[model samples]
Target: MRRVIIIVLVLLPLAVLAVWIGVRAHRLRPKSAIPAGTSATAPGPQLPSPSSCGAAGRSQLEHYDRSTVYDWLDGGAAPYLDHGFTTSTVATYRFETGGRTLTIEAAAVRFASPRGAAAQAAAETPPGAAPVPGLPGAHSTRDVLVWCRGRDMLRLVSFTPGAETSGPFAALARAWLGGTAP
Candidate 1:
């Protein structure tokens, strides 16, 4: 009976101390801190998207010689071409640089549109010319030219078709643009 009493006395005090330390430690932690055992090394606010990043999506060292841009292409029939079977029309862009004119949009044809080839071809035909048959889902496409001189890169992007993306995609875009990634 005496040994049992002594053992309880020692264990009871230790248990109380342990409970006190645990409560104190819990209260001391910041409300914002992630719980222990979380996988992420650093956790906090996340970026919305890469597009929001200043130059993200928009290329760095980007500048286009507007003068080099020659034509706004529309796809349609090629009844006018020498080797014609109602092929799509090719819009031409003419440019003069270093005393040499370089055309940019000579290859303006849609080879694989869901719409019938006829409709795809019709998108390019000049409006005044005899109206060409349009494909069911044929669409007029608009593109932009961006040249990153330092990178020696020429990019053509379709902005007419507004894009849809998820939160993570937006965050990634914003990050690439300039914001911090998630």
Candidate 2:
């Protein structure tokens, strides 16, 4: 009976540990970035392909709905949520320039209306942002460019200083905006 009890005690903890590991693995598994009921290849506004912008590589697209926006934006999700955000798609692109690699992050967020998009863009615009040429409702700073069209807003950000003026930035923005026809 004592041997059986010892075996039970050891087996219980092992079982518990196995269950814990399973739970952790489940939580860590990658969730489908595409929204439910939507085909992965559905025709829609998509992030610009790397080849379209001369990017060396591009990350997989990630889509976030209202419920999961926080997973991507955390505290910054509040403004978007308040502005009737519908969905957001994000990706990163890498470009080789001047013997260095630059990473530009891009996001396309859709709102309930054009008014909401303009409001959100206005809220994010800094005092000194200059309007981007040929792209109405678009502005660019030293490292960030933001634009709104209809009910969609697109932002391209670069951490590399002064990357906003690089070839990749312009190409990517142009390619992305070109694909976002009203």
What TM-score would every model get versus the actual structure? Answer: 0.19, 0.72
What 10-residue stretch in candidate 2 is worst by lDDT? 35-44
Error of 2 at 169 (Å): 2.3
1-182 in candidate 2: lDDT tens per residue? 99999999999999999999999999898677654422233233468888887888988777777777787788999999999998877888898887888988988889999999999988887779888776766888878888888898888888688654546667887888778431
Poorest stretch of ten by lDDT in candidate 1: 60-69
Can you write out model 1's per-residue Cα lDDT over 21-119, one digit (the tens) per residue?
A: 999999887756543222222222222221342222222121112111121221212322212222122222333334543332212222222233343
**Number of the top candidate by TM-score?**
2
Q: List the RMSD of every prediction in angstroms.
A: 20.8, 8.3
